[model samples]
Target: MAIDDRVGQAGSGVRRDLRDALAVLAATPRLLVALDFDGTLAPVVDDPEKARATPEASRAVERLIALADTRVALVSGRALKDLEQVAPFGDEVLLVGSHGIELRLDEADDVLALDADERQQLGVLEQVLDQMAGTLDSVWIEPKPAGFAVHTRLASERHSRVAHLVAINELKAEAPDATVRLGKDVIEFSVRSTTKGEAVEHLRRYTHASAVFYAGDDVTDEDAFVALTADDLGLKSGVGPTAADHRVAGPAEVASVLSLLATLREAHAADAPDTN
Candidate 1:
Protein backbone atom coordinates (compact mmCIF):
# COMPACT_ATOMS: atom_id res chain seq x y z
CA MET A 1 0.00 0.00 0.00
CA ALA A 2 1.14 3.55 -0.69
CA ILE A 3 1.04 6.52 1.64
CA ASP A 4 -2.63 7.45 2.02
CA ASP A 5 -3.17 10.50 -0.13
CA ARG A 6 -6.50 11.09 1.49
CA VAL A 7 -6.12 13.00 4.75
CA GLY A 8 -9.46 12.41 6.46
CA GLN A 9 -11.13 14.38 9.20
CA ALA A 10 -9.78 13.45 12.65
CA GLY A 11 -12.80 12.47 14.76
CA SER A 12 -15.67 10.21 13.84
CA GLY A 13 -17.45 7.07 15.00
CA VAL A 14 -15.67 5.25 12.20
CA ARG A 15 -12.32 6.21 13.70
CA ARG A 16 -13.35 4.91 17.11
CA ASP A 17 -14.22 1.52 15.62
CA LEU A 18 -10.66 1.18 14.34
CA ARG A 19 -9.30 1.40 17.89
CA ASP A 20 -11.84 -1.22 18.89
CA ALA A 21 -10.59 -3.43 16.07
CA LEU A 22 -6.98 -3.02 17.23
CA ALA A 23 -7.98 -4.51 20.57
CA VAL A 24 -9.27 -7.53 18.66
CA LEU A 25 -6.11 -7.92 16.57
CA ALA A 26 -3.98 -7.95 19.70
CA ALA A 27 -5.45 -11.36 20.57
CA THR A 28 -4.73 -13.05 17.26
CA PRO A 29 -2.24 -15.94 17.05
CA ARG A 30 0.39 -14.25 14.87
CA LEU A 31 0.63 -10.63 16.05
CA LEU A 32 2.96 -8.00 14.71
CA VAL A 33 2.49 -5.03 17.02
CA ALA A 34 4.26 -1.76 16.23
CA LEU A 35 3.93 1.34 18.38
CA ASP A 36 5.31 4.88 18.42
CA PHE A 37 7.01 5.68 21.70
CA ASP A 38 6.64 9.30 22.85
CA GLY A 39 3.02 10.40 22.94
CA THR A 40 1.52 7.01 22.29
CA LEU A 41 3.04 4.68 24.88
CA ALA A 42 4.11 7.34 27.36
CA PRO A 43 2.27 10.50 28.28
CA VAL A 44 3.60 13.73 26.79
CA VAL A 45 5.61 15.26 29.61
CA ASP A 46 7.52 18.51 30.18
CA ASP A 47 10.83 16.71 30.34
CA PRO A 48 11.36 14.20 27.57
CA GLU A 49 13.79 12.21 29.72
CA LYS A 50 11.11 11.60 32.33
CA ALA A 51 8.96 10.00 29.67
CA ARG A 52 8.74 6.39 30.80
CA ALA A 53 6.13 3.78 30.00
CA THR A 54 3.38 3.64 32.58
CA PRO A 55 3.74 0.68 34.93
CA GLU A 56 0.42 -0.84 33.86
CA ALA A 57 1.27 -0.45 30.18
CA SER A 58 4.72 -1.92 30.72
CA ARG A 59 3.30 -4.92 32.58
CA ALA A 60 0.73 -5.50 29.86
CA VAL A 61 3.37 -5.40 27.15
CA GLU A 62 5.41 -7.97 29.07
CA ARG A 63 2.42 -10.28 29.24
CA LEU A 64 1.82 -9.89 25.51
CA ILE A 65 5.47 -10.78 24.85
CA ALA A 66 4.98 -14.08 26.68
CA LEU A 67 2.70 -15.26 23.90
CA ALA A 68 4.81 -17.48 21.67
CA ASP A 69 3.40 -16.19 18.41
CA THR A 70 3.39 -12.49 19.18
CA ARG A 71 6.09 -10.14 17.87
CA VAL A 72 6.23 -6.59 19.19
CA ALA A 73 8.32 -3.73 17.87
CA LEU A 74 9.04 -0.33 19.38
CA VAL A 75 9.36 2.10 16.50
CA SER A 76 10.57 5.48 17.79
CA GLY A 77 12.40 8.72 17.01
CA ARG A 78 14.87 8.14 19.85
CA ALA A 79 18.14 6.34 19.24
CA LEU A 80 18.37 2.62 20.07
CA LYS A 81 20.28 3.28 23.31
CA ASP A 82 17.69 5.82 24.51
CA LEU A 83 14.79 3.55 23.55
CA GLU A 84 16.35 0.69 25.49
CA GLN A 85 16.37 2.86 28.60
CA VAL A 86 12.55 3.35 28.64
CA ALA A 87 11.09 0.24 26.99
CA PRO A 88 9.30 -2.12 29.37
CA PHE A 89 10.77 -5.53 28.56
CA GLY A 90 14.41 -5.03 27.69
CA ASP A 91 15.33 -6.76 24.44
CA GLU A 92 11.98 -8.61 24.38
CA VAL A 93 10.45 -6.23 21.86
CA LEU A 94 12.25 -5.60 18.59
CA LEU A 95 13.66 -2.07 18.75
CA VAL A 96 13.38 -0.05 15.54
CA GLY A 97 15.11 3.10 16.61
CA SER A 98 16.20 6.33 14.90
CA HIS A 99 12.97 6.36 12.91
CA GLY A 100 13.71 2.78 11.86
CA ILE A 101 17.16 3.70 10.66
CA GLU A 102 18.51 1.01 13.03
CA LEU A 103 16.81 -2.18 14.14
CA ARG A 104 17.89 -4.62 16.84
CA LEU A 105 16.54 -7.58 18.70
CA ASP A 106 17.71 -8.95 22.08
CA GLU A 107 21.22 -7.51 21.83
CA ALA A 108 22.51 -4.05 22.66
CA ASP A 109 25.53 -4.18 20.36
CA ASP A 110 23.45 -5.72 17.58
CA VAL A 111 22.30 -3.16 14.96
CA LEU A 112 21.14 -3.14 11.37
CA ALA A 113 23.28 -0.82 9.28
CA LEU A 114 21.56 2.05 7.47
CA ASP A 115 21.96 2.76 3.76
CA ALA A 116 25.15 4.40 2.41
CA ASP A 117 23.79 7.87 1.62
CA GLU A 118 22.21 8.08 5.08
CA ARG A 119 25.54 7.20 6.69
CA GLN A 120 27.37 10.00 4.86
CA GLN A 121 24.74 12.75 5.32
CA LEU A 122 24.22 12.10 9.03
CA GLY A 123 27.90 12.90 9.67
CA VAL A 124 27.66 16.26 7.90
CA LEU A 125 24.32 17.33 9.47
CA GLU A 126 25.70 16.68 12.99
CA GLN A 127 28.33 19.33 12.60
CA VAL A 128 26.12 21.87 10.81
CA LEU A 129 23.33 21.72 13.42
CA ASP A 130 25.79 22.17 16.29
CA GLN A 131 27.19 25.35 14.75
CA MET A 132 23.66 26.81 14.28
CA ALA A 133 22.44 25.87 17.83
CA GLY A 134 23.52 29.08 19.55
CA THR A 135 21.32 31.23 17.32
CA LEU A 136 18.27 29.00 17.86
CA ASP A 137 17.14 29.00 21.51
CA SER A 138 14.39 26.59 22.62
CA VAL A 139 15.25 25.16 19.22
CA TRP A 140 17.84 22.66 20.40
CA ILE A 141 19.17 20.12 17.93
CA GLU A 142 19.04 16.60 19.30
CA PRO A 143 21.85 14.43 17.99
CA LYS A 144 20.79 10.79 17.94
CA PRO A 145 23.42 8.18 17.24
CA ALA A 146 21.85 7.52 13.85
CA GLY A 147 20.02 10.80 13.16
CA PHE A 148 19.28 14.31 14.44
CA ALA A 149 16.16 16.23 15.59
CA VAL A 150 15.55 20.01 15.74
CA HIS A 151 13.11 20.67 18.57
CA THR A 152 11.08 23.87 19.06
CA ARG A 153 9.00 22.59 21.96
CA LEU A 154 10.74 24.78 24.48
CA ALA A 155 10.61 27.91 22.38
CA SER A 156 8.15 30.74 23.02
CA GLU A 157 5.18 30.72 20.67
CA ARG A 158 6.69 33.35 18.38
CA HIS A 159 10.18 31.87 18.47
CA SER A 160 8.80 28.37 18.00
CA ARG A 161 7.56 29.41 14.58
CA VAL A 162 10.83 31.14 13.82
CA ALA A 163 12.87 28.17 15.02
CA HIS A 164 11.02 25.78 12.75
CA LEU A 165 11.56 28.02 9.75
CA VAL A 166 15.23 28.57 10.51
CA ALA A 167 15.91 24.89 11.14
CA ILE A 168 14.08 23.75 8.01
CA ASN A 169 15.93 26.26 5.85
CA GLU A 170 19.31 25.40 7.34
CA LEU A 171 18.81 21.65 7.25
CA LYS A 172 17.68 21.65 3.64
CA ALA A 173 20.62 23.74 2.51
CA GLU A 174 23.30 22.15 4.72
CA ALA A 175 22.21 18.50 4.60
CA PRO A 176 21.48 18.20 0.90
CA ASP A 177 21.86 14.41 1.05
CA ALA A 178 19.61 13.99 4.09
CA THR A 179 15.83 13.61 4.20
CA VAL A 180 14.31 16.63 5.92
CA ARG A 181 11.09 15.80 7.79
CA LEU A 182 8.58 17.80 9.80
CA GLY A 183 6.80 16.72 12.99
CA LYS A 184 5.07 18.08 16.07
CA ASP A 185 7.43 20.62 17.61
CA VAL A 186 10.38 19.13 15.76
CA ILE A 187 11.99 18.75 12.39
CA GLU A 188 14.02 15.61 11.74
CA PHE A 189 16.86 15.45 9.26
CA SER A 190 18.03 11.95 8.53
CA VAL A 191 20.20 10.19 6.00
CA ARG A 192 17.83 7.21 5.67
CA SER A 193 16.11 6.99 2.31
CA THR A 194 13.43 4.82 3.86
CA THR A 195 10.52 6.46 5.64
CA LYS A 196 8.33 5.05 8.41
CA GLY A 197 6.08 3.50 5.77
CA GLU A 198 8.99 1.52 4.40
CA ALA A 199 9.91 0.44 7.91
CA VAL A 200 6.47 -1.17 8.39
CA GLU A 201 6.78 -2.92 5.05
CA HIS A 202 10.11 -4.44 6.13
CA LEU A 203 8.65 -5.66 9.42
CA ARG A 204 5.60 -7.09 7.66
CA ARG A 205 7.82 -9.24 5.50
CA TYR A 206 10.11 -10.20 8.40
CA THR A 207 7.28 -11.27 10.72
CA HIS A 208 4.90 -12.42 7.96
CA ALA A 209 2.12 -10.64 9.80
CA SER A 210 -1.26 -11.35 8.27
CA ALA A 211 -2.49 -8.03 9.62
CA VAL A 212 -0.37 -5.03 10.60
CA PHE A 213 -1.50 -2.85 13.51
CA TYR A 214 0.39 0.39 14.11
CA ALA A 215 -0.30 3.18 16.61
CA GLY A 216 1.23 6.63 16.93
CA ASP A 217 0.52 10.27 17.78
CA ASP A 218 2.91 12.42 15.79
CA VAL A 219 3.14 13.82 12.27
CA THR A 220 6.12 11.61 11.39
CA ASP A 221 4.08 8.55 12.35
CA GLU A 222 1.42 9.44 9.76
CA ASP A 223 3.49 7.86 7.02
CA ALA A 224 3.17 4.47 8.67
CA PHE A 225 -0.55 4.92 9.27
CA VAL A 226 -1.05 5.90 5.66
CA ALA A 227 0.77 2.79 4.51
CA LEU A 228 -1.78 0.47 6.11
CA THR A 229 -4.02 -1.60 3.88
CA ALA A 230 -7.67 -2.41 4.47
CA ASP A 231 -6.79 -5.51 6.44
CA ASP A 232 -4.26 -3.67 8.57
CA LEU A 233 -5.06 -1.37 11.51
CA GLY A 234 -3.83 2.18 11.97
CA LEU A 235 -4.66 4.01 15.20
CA LYS A 236 -4.26 7.70 16.01
CA SER A 237 -3.51 8.67 19.62
CA GLY A 238 -4.96 12.17 19.86
CA VAL A 239 -7.73 14.33 18.48
CA GLY A 240 -6.82 15.50 14.98
CA PRO A 241 -7.22 14.89 11.28
CA THR A 242 -5.28 11.72 10.56
CA ALA A 243 -4.69 8.94 8.08
CA ALA A 244 -5.09 6.41 10.90
CA ASP A 245 -7.98 3.98 10.77
CA HIS A 246 -8.69 4.33 14.49
CA ARG A 247 -8.61 7.01 17.18
CA VAL A 248 -8.13 6.93 20.97
CA ALA A 249 -8.38 9.63 23.63
CA GLY A 250 -4.83 9.37 24.90
CA PRO A 251 -2.07 7.06 26.15
CA ALA A 252 -4.23 5.80 29.00
CA GLU A 253 -6.84 4.65 26.51
CA VAL A 254 -4.13 2.93 24.49
CA ALA A 255 -3.13 0.98 27.60
CA SER A 256 -6.72 -0.08 28.16
CA VAL A 257 -6.96 -1.39 24.63
CA LEU A 258 -3.69 -3.28 25.07
CA SER A 259 -4.79 -4.75 28.38
CA LEU A 260 -7.99 -5.97 26.82
CA LEU A 261 -5.94 -7.62 24.12
CA ALA A 262 -3.84 -9.51 26.66
CA THR A 263 -6.98 -10.81 28.34
CA LEU A 264 -8.25 -12.07 25.03
CA ARG A 265 -4.91 -13.73 24.30
CA GLU A 266 -4.92 -15.51 27.65
CA ALA A 267 -8.42 -16.76 27.03
CA HIS A 268 -7.46 -18.10 23.62
CA ALA A 269 -4.41 -19.87 25.01
CA ALA A 270 -6.46 -21.49 27.73
CA ASP A 271 -8.96 -22.83 25.19
CA ALA A 272 -6.36 -24.44 22.94
CA PRO A 273 -5.91 -28.16 23.60
CA ASP A 274 -2.51 -29.26 24.88
CA THR A 275 -0.79 -32.29 23.37
CA ASN A 276 1.21 -32.81 26.55
Candidate 2:
Protein backbone atom coordinates (compact mmCIF):
# COMPACT_ATOMS: atom_id res chain seq x y z
CA MET A 1 0.00 0.00 0.00
CA ALA A 2 1.04 3.61 -0.53
CA ILE A 3 2.07 5.87 2.38
CA ASP A 4 -1.22 7.76 2.29
CA ASP A 5 -3.20 4.53 2.18
CA ARG A 6 -1.21 3.24 5.16
CA VAL A 7 -2.31 6.28 7.14
CA GLY A 8 -5.91 5.72 6.11
CA GLN A 9 -5.87 1.93 6.66
CA ALA A 10 -4.84 0.06 9.78
CA GLY A 11 -2.30 -2.48 8.43
CA SER A 12 -0.83 -1.21 5.21
CA GLY A 13 2.65 -0.08 3.99
CA VAL A 14 4.00 0.98 7.38
CA ARG A 15 2.45 -2.07 9.00
CA ARG A 16 3.64 -4.47 6.29
CA ASP A 17 7.17 -3.08 6.36
CA LEU A 18 7.20 -3.30 10.14
CA ARG A 19 6.02 -6.93 9.95
CA ASP A 20 8.76 -7.78 7.45
CA ALA A 21 11.39 -6.10 9.59
CA LEU A 22 10.27 -7.95 12.69
CA ALA A 23 10.31 -11.28 10.85
CA VAL A 24 13.92 -10.58 9.95
CA LEU A 25 14.60 -9.56 13.54
CA ALA A 26 13.08 -12.72 14.97
CA ALA A 27 14.62 -15.04 12.37
CA THR A 28 18.05 -13.89 13.40
CA PRO A 29 19.00 -14.86 16.93
CA ARG A 30 21.34 -11.88 17.35
CA LEU A 31 19.48 -8.64 16.69
CA LEU A 32 20.44 -5.21 17.93
CA VAL A 33 17.96 -2.33 18.06
CA ALA A 34 19.21 1.19 18.66
CA LEU A 35 17.10 4.33 18.74
CA ASP A 36 17.44 8.05 19.35
CA PHE A 37 15.20 9.37 22.12
CA ASP A 38 13.89 12.87 21.37
CA GLY A 39 12.02 13.23 18.08
CA THR A 40 12.28 9.49 17.53
CA LEU A 41 10.71 7.76 20.53
CA ALA A 42 9.29 10.90 22.15
CA PRO A 43 8.02 14.10 20.58
CA VAL A 44 10.47 16.96 20.68
CA VAL A 45 9.54 19.53 23.31
CA ASP A 46 10.56 23.06 24.36
CA ASP A 47 11.44 21.91 27.86
CA PRO A 48 13.59 18.86 27.11
CA GLU A 49 13.02 17.56 30.63
CA LYS A 50 9.27 17.43 30.03
CA ALA A 51 9.74 15.13 27.03
CA ARG A 52 8.37 11.68 27.82
CA ALA A 53 7.62 8.67 25.66
CA THR A 54 4.06 8.19 24.49
CA PRO A 55 2.31 5.29 26.25
CA GLU A 56 1.69 3.43 23.01
CA ALA A 57 5.30 3.79 21.87
CA SER A 58 6.70 2.76 25.24
CA ARG A 59 4.51 -0.32 25.38
CA ALA A 60 5.45 -1.33 21.84
CA VAL A 61 9.17 -1.22 22.61
CA GLU A 62 8.62 -3.09 25.85
CA ARG A 63 6.74 -5.78 23.93
CA LEU A 64 9.50 -5.99 21.33
CA ILE A 65 12.04 -6.55 24.11
CA ALA A 66 9.90 -9.24 25.70
CA LEU A 67 9.15 -11.11 22.46
CA ALA A 68 12.33 -10.84 20.42
CA ASP A 69 15.77 -12.18 21.24
CA THR A 70 17.13 -8.68 20.92
CA ARG A 71 19.21 -6.20 22.87
CA VAL A 72 17.69 -2.73 22.82
CA ALA A 73 19.66 0.49 23.25
CA LEU A 74 18.78 4.14 23.70
CA VAL A 75 21.40 6.46 22.25
CA SER A 76 21.08 10.22 22.59
CA GLY A 77 22.96 13.49 22.99
CA ARG A 78 21.46 13.95 26.47
CA ALA A 79 23.48 13.18 29.57
CA LEU A 80 23.27 9.64 31.02
CA LYS A 81 21.05 10.61 33.94
CA ASP A 82 18.89 12.85 31.78
CA LEU A 83 18.42 10.26 29.02
CA GLU A 84 17.38 7.69 31.61
CA GLN A 85 14.69 10.00 32.91
CA VAL A 86 13.32 10.58 29.40
CA ALA A 87 13.74 7.18 27.77
CA PRO A 88 10.67 4.94 27.58
CA PHE A 89 12.50 1.65 28.17
CA GLY A 90 14.41 3.12 31.11
CA ASP A 91 17.20 0.93 32.60
CA GLU A 92 15.85 -2.14 30.80
CA VAL A 93 17.26 -0.69 27.58
CA LEU A 94 21.02 -0.23 27.30
CA LEU A 95 21.79 3.49 27.51
CA VAL A 96 24.29 5.32 25.32
CA GLY A 97 24.08 8.90 26.55
CA SER A 98 26.13 12.07 26.03
CA HIS A 99 26.42 11.30 22.35
CA GLY A 100 27.49 7.83 23.44
CA ILE A 101 30.15 9.25 25.75
CA GLU A 102 28.52 7.50 28.71
CA LEU A 103 27.11 3.96 28.41
CA ARG A 104 25.20 1.74 30.76
CA LEU A 105 24.22 -1.84 30.13
CA ASP A 106 21.49 -2.29 32.69
CA GLU A 107 21.58 0.45 35.33
CA ALA A 108 22.77 4.02 35.93
CA ASP A 109 25.46 2.77 38.33
CA ASP A 110 26.80 0.69 35.46
CA VAL A 111 27.40 3.90 33.47
CA LEU A 112 30.80 4.44 31.94
CA ALA A 113 32.01 7.77 33.30
CA LEU A 114 33.65 10.50 31.22
CA ASP A 115 37.37 11.26 31.34
CA ALA A 116 39.11 14.20 33.08
CA ASP A 117 39.56 16.63 30.17
CA GLU A 118 36.02 15.91 29.00
CA ARG A 119 34.87 16.75 32.52
CA GLN A 120 36.83 20.03 32.46
CA GLN A 121 35.29 20.93 29.09
CA LEU A 122 31.89 20.73 30.79
CA GLY A 123 33.07 23.43 33.24
CA VAL A 124 34.36 25.59 30.39
CA LEU A 125 31.07 25.16 28.54
CA GLU A 126 29.00 26.17 31.55
CA GLN A 127 30.47 29.70 31.43
CA VAL A 128 29.81 30.08 27.72
CA LEU A 129 26.27 28.70 28.08
CA ASP A 130 25.50 31.08 30.95
CA GLN A 131 26.45 34.03 28.75
CA MET A 132 24.31 32.75 25.84
CA ALA A 133 21.31 32.24 28.13
CA GLY A 134 21.72 35.78 29.47
CA THR A 135 21.80 37.29 25.99
CA LEU A 136 18.91 35.35 24.43
CA ASP A 137 15.31 35.42 25.69
CA SER A 138 13.24 32.21 25.74
CA VAL A 139 16.52 30.37 25.08
CA TRP A 140 18.22 27.90 27.40
CA ILE A 141 21.18 25.53 27.67
CA GLU A 142 21.55 21.81 28.34
CA PRO A 143 24.87 20.50 29.68
CA LYS A 144 26.06 16.97 28.89
CA PRO A 145 29.12 14.87 29.73
CA ALA A 146 31.43 16.11 26.99
CA GLY A 147 29.43 19.01 25.61
CA PHE A 148 26.82 21.73 26.02
CA ALA A 149 23.82 22.82 23.94
CA VAL A 150 21.80 25.98 23.44
CA HIS A 151 18.14 25.27 22.60
CA THR A 152 15.96 27.87 20.88
CA ARG A 153 12.98 25.70 19.98
CA LEU A 154 10.68 27.86 22.12
CA ALA A 155 12.03 31.16 20.74
CA SER A 156 10.97 32.94 17.58
CA GLU A 157 12.70 31.73 14.41
CA ARG A 158 14.72 34.99 14.18
CA HIS A 159 15.91 34.73 17.78
CA SER A 160 16.64 31.03 17.24
CA ARG A 161 18.95 31.85 14.34
CA VAL A 162 20.61 34.64 16.30
CA ALA A 163 21.08 32.40 19.33
CA HIS A 164 22.58 29.71 17.14
CA LEU A 165 25.13 32.14 15.69
CA VAL A 166 26.01 33.60 19.09
CA ALA A 167 26.29 30.19 20.72
CA ILE A 168 28.52 28.95 17.89
CA ASN A 169 30.87 31.91 18.20
CA GLU A 170 31.00 31.75 22.01
CA LEU A 171 31.55 27.99 22.12
CA LYS A 172 34.18 28.17 19.39
CA ALA A 173 36.04 30.79 21.38
CA GLU A 174 35.71 28.87 24.64
CA ALA A 175 36.62 25.42 23.35
CA PRO A 176 38.64 25.85 20.18
CA ASP A 177 39.89 22.26 20.34
CA ALA A 178 36.40 20.81 20.73
CA THR A 179 34.18 19.92 17.77
CA VAL A 180 31.23 22.26 17.37
CA ARG A 181 28.02 20.95 15.79
CA LEU A 182 24.50 22.18 15.10
CA GLY A 183 21.10 20.49 15.15
CA LYS A 184 17.45 21.46 14.75
CA ASP A 185 16.95 24.48 17.04
CA VAL A 186 20.09 23.55 18.95
CA ILE A 187 23.86 24.10 18.85
CA GLU A 188 26.41 21.87 20.53
CA PHE A 189 30.13 21.64 21.34
CA SER A 190 31.85 18.45 22.38
CA VAL A 191 35.22 16.69 22.55
CA ARG A 192 36.64 15.40 19.27
CA SER A 193 36.07 11.61 19.55
CA THR A 194 32.66 11.46 21.21
CA THR A 195 30.40 11.21 18.16
CA LYS A 196 27.39 9.15 17.08
CA GLY A 197 29.35 7.30 14.37
CA GLU A 198 32.01 6.25 16.85
CA ALA A 199 29.25 5.23 19.23
CA VAL A 200 27.64 2.96 16.60
CA GLU A 201 30.95 1.33 15.77
CA HIS A 202 31.64 0.67 19.42
CA LEU A 203 28.19 -0.72 20.16
CA ARG A 204 28.24 -2.99 17.12
CA ARG A 205 31.60 -4.43 18.18
CA TYR A 206 30.61 -4.83 21.82
CA THR A 207 27.28 -6.48 21.09
CA HIS A 208 28.59 -8.43 18.07
CA ALA A 209 25.30 -7.49 16.49
CA SER A 210 25.04 -9.50 13.27
CA ALA A 211 21.91 -7.57 12.33
CA VAL A 212 21.15 -4.00 13.33
CA PHE A 213 18.23 -1.60 13.11
CA TYR A 214 18.86 2.06 13.94
CA ALA A 215 16.16 4.74 14.00
CA GLY A 216 16.69 8.43 14.66
CA ASP A 217 15.85 12.03 13.76
CA ASP A 218 18.23 15.00 13.86
CA VAL A 219 21.59 16.06 12.44
CA THR A 220 23.58 14.08 14.99
CA ASP A 221 21.80 10.87 13.96
CA GLU A 222 23.35 11.27 10.51
CA ASP A 223 26.56 9.88 11.95
CA ALA A 224 24.88 6.59 12.82
CA PHE A 225 23.10 6.52 9.44
CA VAL A 226 26.45 6.75 7.68
CA ALA A 227 27.87 4.01 9.89
CA LEU A 228 25.11 1.56 8.93
CA THR A 229 25.94 -1.15 6.37
CA ALA A 230 23.72 -2.48 3.58
CA ASP A 231 22.46 -5.41 5.68
CA ASP A 232 21.47 -3.10 8.52
CA LEU A 233 18.33 -0.96 8.60
CA GLY A 234 18.78 2.81 8.94
CA LEU A 235 15.53 4.66 9.53
CA LYS A 236 15.01 8.41 9.45
CA SER A 237 12.10 9.27 11.72
CA GLY A 238 11.23 12.75 10.38
CA VAL A 239 11.25 14.74 7.18
CA GLY A 240 14.33 15.19 4.97
CA PRO A 241 16.85 12.63 3.75
CA THR A 242 16.24 9.90 1.21
CA ALA A 243 19.51 8.62 2.71
CA ALA A 244 17.89 6.32 5.26
CA ASP A 245 16.67 2.83 4.29
CA HIS A 246 13.22 3.80 5.54
CA ARG A 247 11.61 7.18 6.22
CA VAL A 248 9.00 7.73 8.91
CA ALA A 249 6.85 10.79 9.51
CA GLY A 250 7.20 11.27 13.29
CA PRO A 251 7.21 9.58 16.72
CA ALA A 252 3.66 8.29 16.25
CA GLU A 253 4.60 6.61 13.00
CA VAL A 254 7.64 5.16 14.72
CA ALA A 255 5.36 3.79 17.43
CA SER A 256 3.10 2.33 14.82
CA VAL A 257 6.08 0.61 13.24
CA LEU A 258 7.16 -0.85 16.57
CA SER A 259 3.66 -2.02 17.42
CA LEU A 260 3.39 -3.82 14.09
CA LEU A 261 6.76 -5.44 14.77
CA ALA A 262 5.44 -6.78 18.07
CA THR A 263 2.40 -8.25 16.32
CA LEU A 264 4.51 -9.78 13.57
CA ARG A 265 6.78 -11.47 16.06
CA GLU A 266 3.78 -13.27 17.50
CA ALA A 267 2.61 -14.25 14.03
CA HIS A 268 6.01 -15.70 13.13
CA ALA A 269 6.20 -17.62 16.40
CA ALA A 270 2.83 -19.23 15.72
CA ASP A 271 3.69 -20.07 12.12
CA ALA A 272 6.75 -22.09 13.07
CA PRO A 273 5.85 -25.77 13.08
CA ASP A 274 8.68 -26.88 15.40
CA THR A 275 8.38 -26.38 19.14
CA ASN A 276 12.01 -25.24 19.38
Quantify all predictions' global Cα lDDT against the true fold: 0.73, 0.75
Clash-forming residue pairs, model 1: 118-191
Residue pairs with backbone overlap in model 2: none
Candidate 1 lDDT for residue 176: 69
- What TM-scores do the predictions have? 0.84, 0.84
lDDT tens string, model 2, 1-276? 333332244335474565455556655555677888999999998778899877878987897677545677888988878887777475567888878778887433454556788677777878877877887788887766666777788888888888878777877787777777778888777763577778888788877888777889988999998998866878889987646778889998888776665665555555556544
Residue-by-residue lDDT tens digits, candidate 1, 46-150? 678889877766766887788767778888888877888877476678878778777876555455566677677777887777776677666788887657888
Q: Residue 67 of candidate 1: its Cα lDDT? A: 75
Top lDDT: which candidate number?
Answer: 2
For each of the candidates, give the backbone clash count: 1, 0
